[model samples]
Structure formats: C-alpha cells, structure tokens
Target: MLQLVDFIARNRFFLVFVLLEIFSGWLIVRSNSYWGATYFNTSNYYVAKTLAFSNSAREYTRLGEINSDLANENARLNALVATLSQKNAKDAPVGYVPDSAFNARFTYKVAKVVDNETNRTNNYITIDKGSADGIEPDMGVISATGVVGKVRFCSKNYSIVTSILHPQFMVSSKLIRSNEIGTAKWPGKDPNFVDMVDVSRYTKVYKGDSAVTSNVNAVFPPGIMVGKVKSVTVHPDQTFYNIVLELATDFRNLSYVYVVKNRQLGEQETLKQRLGDRR
Candidate 1:
C-alpha cells in the first residue's frame, strides 16, 4: 500500500496533465460545432469499421455450417428434379418411349461425396449417405454434370461407391447421335477416359458424339450422361469400334452425387424371375 502511494505520488503530475488534456478536448468539442462535428465524424468512422470487422468475423466463423446447409439444400433440389423428370418421362405415350427401356428405369437419391479418390487403379468414393438413406448396392450414382458410379456397399450413415474409374465398373452406354450402344469400361489408364466397346464400325460414330446410358441392361436410367466421344478407332481385324470417351464429371473434384434407386426394383426382379420360370 505504501509503495502504491509512493508510485502514485511520483506520477501525480503526469496523471494530472493527462486528465487536463482530456477535459480540454471535451470542452472544445462541446463548445464548438466544428470540433464536435469533426469528433463525431472520426468516432463514427471508427465505430463503423469496428462493427463491420466484428460482423465479418462472426460470419467467417459460421461459413462451414452455412456451406453444409447450402449443399444439403442443393441435394434436395436435385432429388426433386430427378423425380419430376422421371414422372414426366413415364407420363409420355408408351409408343413414344424408346425401345431401350433405359429412360425410365431408375430413381435418384441425393448424397454428398464426403471422400473421393481417383489416382489409384481401384479408386472408390465415400458418400455421406447409406442404406438407411435408401441407398443400396448396384444403385447408379451421378452428379449434376454426369454419371459418377454405383453404390457398392452401405451402412447406416455412410456408403462406399465403386467409382466409374474402377476397372470393374461397366455401364451400358450408347452414342447419342447414332444410337449405337456398347459396354462402357475403364481401362485403368486415364481417369477422364472410358472405353466403349462392341460398337460396330458402321454406326457412324465420330469425335464429340455425346454418350448416355442405354438403360437396356437396366443398370442405370437411359439418358443419364456417360461422356462424349473423344476418339474412335476401328480394330484392325475386328468388326467393332474402339471408342474413347471423355467423362463429363471431374472425378477428383466430386463433391455431391445422387444415388439412383429403382422404386420398382423388387417388382421388376420378381417379374423377371417369373418369366424365367415360365420359359
């Protein structure tokens, strides 16, 4: 206490000067409109800047949560769009429907690709949805841009996807211009390219031809984009066309995907079995 008193006594002259300076400034601002206006303007400027900084800080902290919410909303909208598209396709006249049966074969459920890989030979992806979310094995997966892959396995909260880059992945795809369908396969060479085989050379295929799911095998819905023709070559001795397709989706950057579920899958399977039994 005695030390504190001595310190204060020592600094009393400086403290008094500081207080006097503050009082003089206040008096000048209060008595003069010009000074008051100047002071107010400076104060207001600092206050506005501080408030803006504070608000920005708060918003920055909330960015992740906001992004997640937005992604979920986007997924919901995609699901609604898929549903509506399916309904419209089904309502069309039966005679108008294509004979391929791929156009109306599957339904879609939206999911986010929480984890993805592309550089490996057997690349796989993990989605933030599972069987509990109506995902199932063999369900076709796609994004807004194009087809992704199919669900391989699922748990309650997550699922593993067999990426289109996987060697085991095979999709029934066809040229949009010529309607020449073939088996789409990945040769483990490029993540951006897939091989479309069994297409006859006489199909009139060329570079830049759009390819889509054939839906003939009922694995994926027809019209789901597979890729575009990047190159076409006829095998020396074979009658088939060796076509290279450039995938529409950037596999390394996949963020969101939709798992296609055929609501009538069970009925379709049962009918197939019955037909086989009769045969």
Candidate 2:
C-alpha cells in the first residue's frame, strides 16, 4: 500500500494532465453543437460496428448447428421423396410407370463426419452415428454430391465407413447415357479417380459421362451418382474398357453424409437365402 501511494504521488502530475485533457474534451463536446454532434456520431458508429461484429461472431459460432439441422432436414426430404415415388409407382399402370414414379429402396439418416482418410489403400471414414442411429455394416453412405462409402463397423454411437477410396470398396455402376454396366473400384493410387472395369470395350462411352449405382447392387439404391468418366482406354486383346472416373464425392472436403437404410433389405436377404437353400 505504501509503495502504491508513493508511485501515485510520483505520477500525480501526469495523471492530473490526463484527467484535465479528458475534462476539456468533454466540455468542448458538451458546449459546442458541432463537436457534440460529431462525437455522438462517431461513438454511435463505433457502437453499431461493435454490435454488428458481436452478432456476426455469434452467428458464426452457430454454423455447425445450422449445418447439422440442414443435413437432417435434407435427409427427411429424401425419405419423403422416396416414399412418394413408391406410392406413385404402385398407383401407376403395370409396365408404364412414369420416370418420376420410380422409387429407390433406401431411406436416409444424416450423420456428421468425425474422421476421414483418403491417402491410404484402405482408407476409411468415421461418422457420428451407429447402431443407435440405425447405421449398420453394409449400409451405403453418401454425401449431397454423391456416393461416399459403406458402413464397415459400428459401435453404439459411432460408425466406420469403408470409403470408396479403399481398394476393397467396389460398387456396381453404369453409364447414364449408354446404360453400360461396370464395376467401379479404387486402384489404391488416386483419391480423385476411380476405375470402372468390366464395361465392354464395344460400348460407347464419352468423356464426362456420369456413372451411377446399378439396381443389381443391394447395398446402394439404384441411380445414386457414383462418378464421371475422366478418361477411357482400349487395350489390345482386352474385352473390357479401361476407364478412369472423377469421383463424385470429394473425400478431402467431406463434412456430412447420409447413411442409407434399406427397409426391405432383411426380407430380401431372407428370400434370397431361402431360394439358395432350395436350390
């Protein structure tokens, strides 16, 4: 306390000068109309700007929550579309369903990506969902843009995805224009490119042709986007075309994904198993 008093005493003149300066400025602003107006205007501008900055910061902080809500809403809309299309198909005349009446076998659940890896041969992604969220092994995972992966394993609250970037990950896909079917696979080399194999060499394929999931696959719903043709090559004595595809999902930028839940999958599997048993 003594030291503080001594310090204040030593700086008393300087402190007095600062107080006088503040008082003089206040007097000028109060007495002069121009000064008062200018001071208030400047202070108001700063106050408005500060309030705006605070509001922006608050909104920015809520972006994740906003995005999660949007993703969930999108999932709900997708489910609704699937349900409507199914209803339309059932109501349509046999062998004459409209294109819009064709429905897929899958519904969706939104999940936020928690981890992702694209560089490894067996790359995987993790999401903030699992059995508790109805996610299971073999459930197809997709983003807003396109296919992402399939569920490989899961805990009660988290699931791991076998990414399309993984060498073992393969999906039945077809050329949208030509309807040429092929198997899309990653060759353990490039994350941006996947290889579409088993497409007949004679099939007409073009650059930028979209590849989408085929109905033959039980895991993914038919017509879900897979990728686009980046390049095509023909080899001597080879019956299949060597094709490179620009992947639909950008693994590097993955944030949220939808896990496909095929409601009839269990029934379908049981029937298939019974048929095999009879055979």
Candidate 3:
C-alpha cells in the first residue's frame, strides 16, 4: 500500500498533464463542429478498415468450405450435362428401344483431394470419399478442366486414385481434330506432359490439338478432355508417332475432383469377362 501511494505521488505531475490534455482535446472537439466532424470521420474510417480486415481474415479460414461447396455444385452440373448428352442421342434406334434410365449412365460426386503426389514415378492421389459415396475401383475421376485418374482402391470414406502422372497409367485417347485414337500414358519424366503412343505417324496430328477420351475408354466418358498435343515427332524406324500431351489438370494444384460412376460398369465388366475380351 505504501509503495502504491509512493508510485502515484511520483507520477502525479505527469498523470495530471496527460488528463488535462485529454480533457482539452475533448472540449475542443465538443465545442467545434469542424474538429468533431474530422475526429468522427477519421475514427470511423479506421474502425471500418479494422472491421473489414477482420472479416477478410474470417473468410480466409472458410476457403475450404467454399471450395467444397463449389465442387459439389460442379459435380451436379457434370451429371446433368451427361444426362443431357444421352438424351440428345438417338431416342429410338431402328428395331431397338432404350430404357427410361438409359440417360442416367453416368453420375458424378465431388470429393476433396486430401493428399496428392506429383513428384514420384508412380504418383497416387487420395480423396476424401470412397465406396460409401458410390466410388469404386476403375471409376473415373476428373477435374473441371480434364481427366485426373481412376480409383485403384476404396475404403469406407477414402479412395486411392492411380493418377495419370503414373507411368503405368494409360487411357484411351484421341486427337479431337483427326480423331486418331492412341493410348495416353505418363513417361515418368515430366508432370506437365504425357506420351500418346500408337497414334499412326501418317495421321495429321498437330501441336495444340486437343486429346480427349475416346468412345473406347472403359472408365471415362467419351469426349472428356485429357490434354493437348505438346509435340509430335516420328523417326524412320518407328511406326507410331512420338506424341506428347500437355496435361489439362495441374496435379500439384488439385483441391477437389469429381468421381464418375458408370451405372453399367459392372454389367460391362461381366460381359467382358465372359467373352474373354482380355485386351
């Protein structure tokens, strides 16, 4: 108690001066409209700026939720587009009638990419969805821009995808301009590019030609973009052109993807097994 009294006594003069200064400033602002207006404007301006900054910080924290919502909406749109494309097809072929659910061949669901690998030879991706979400092995996965990969395995709430960057991964693709079909596979060299082999050298392939999933693809829907031709080269000894594709999806930046569920996939596989169409 004695030390507190002594400390106050020591700062009494300075404390009195500070209080007088504050009171004088308040009196000036209260008596003068210009000063009051200036002070209010300045204070309100700073307060508004501080509130804006705080709101922006809060928004930054919710980016994950925002992106997930966008992905879900995009997946729904994709399914709608697929359904429309089916409806535009021949409604009744000669001597054949399609079922009511024929247009519902493909359905899409959004999954956030929880983990991704792009620097390895056999790069894989993990998503925050699985068989519980209707995702299964061999199901197609894609980003908004293009093809991503196929589901290799699935648990109750997660799935591992064999990324297109993997050397062993291959997809049936064709040049959009020439429609020459080829097998798109990674060379284990660069993440931005893939090799499209078996495209006939005689075909008029060009740089910048889009490569898309072909009708022959079992996993992905036809016309879904895979990439664009980065380069096309051929040697005298080679029958097929050495074509390079600049991948559409930047795997390093993947946050979300849409998994494609083909309703007839099981039936198709069963038929293939029975027919011994192993290739």
- The best candidate by TM-score is 3
Model 3 has how many clashing residue pairs? 0
lDDT of model 2, residue 204: 92
Off by over 4 Å in 2: 1-12, 31-33, 81-105
Q: What digit string (tens of lDDT, one per residue) describes model 2 on residues 171-258? A: 9998988889999999999899999999998879999999988868777766678999999999899999999999988889999999
Q: Give one digit per residue, the lDDT tens place, for model 1 in 1-279.
A: 999999999999999999999999999999999999999999999999999999999999998788667766765665565455555664367666443333344556667789998989998999999867877888888887788988888999999999999999999997888878898889999999999999998769979999988747555666778899999988679899889999988888787787877766777889999999999
Backbone clash pairs for candidate 3 read: none
For each candidate, what is the lDDT?
Answer: 0.82, 0.88, 0.89
lDDT at residue 202 of model 2 (Cα atoms) = 87
How far in Å is the alpha carbon of 123 misplaced in model 1?
2.1
Residue-level error in angstroms, candidate 2, position 205: 1.8
With a 3 Å backbone cut-off (N, CA, C), the pairs that clash in candidate 1 are 102-215, 102-222
Q: Count the backbone clashes (under 3 Å) in each candidate.
A: 2, 0, 0
TM-score for each of the candidates? 0.73, 0.81, 0.84
lDDT of 1 at 101: 39
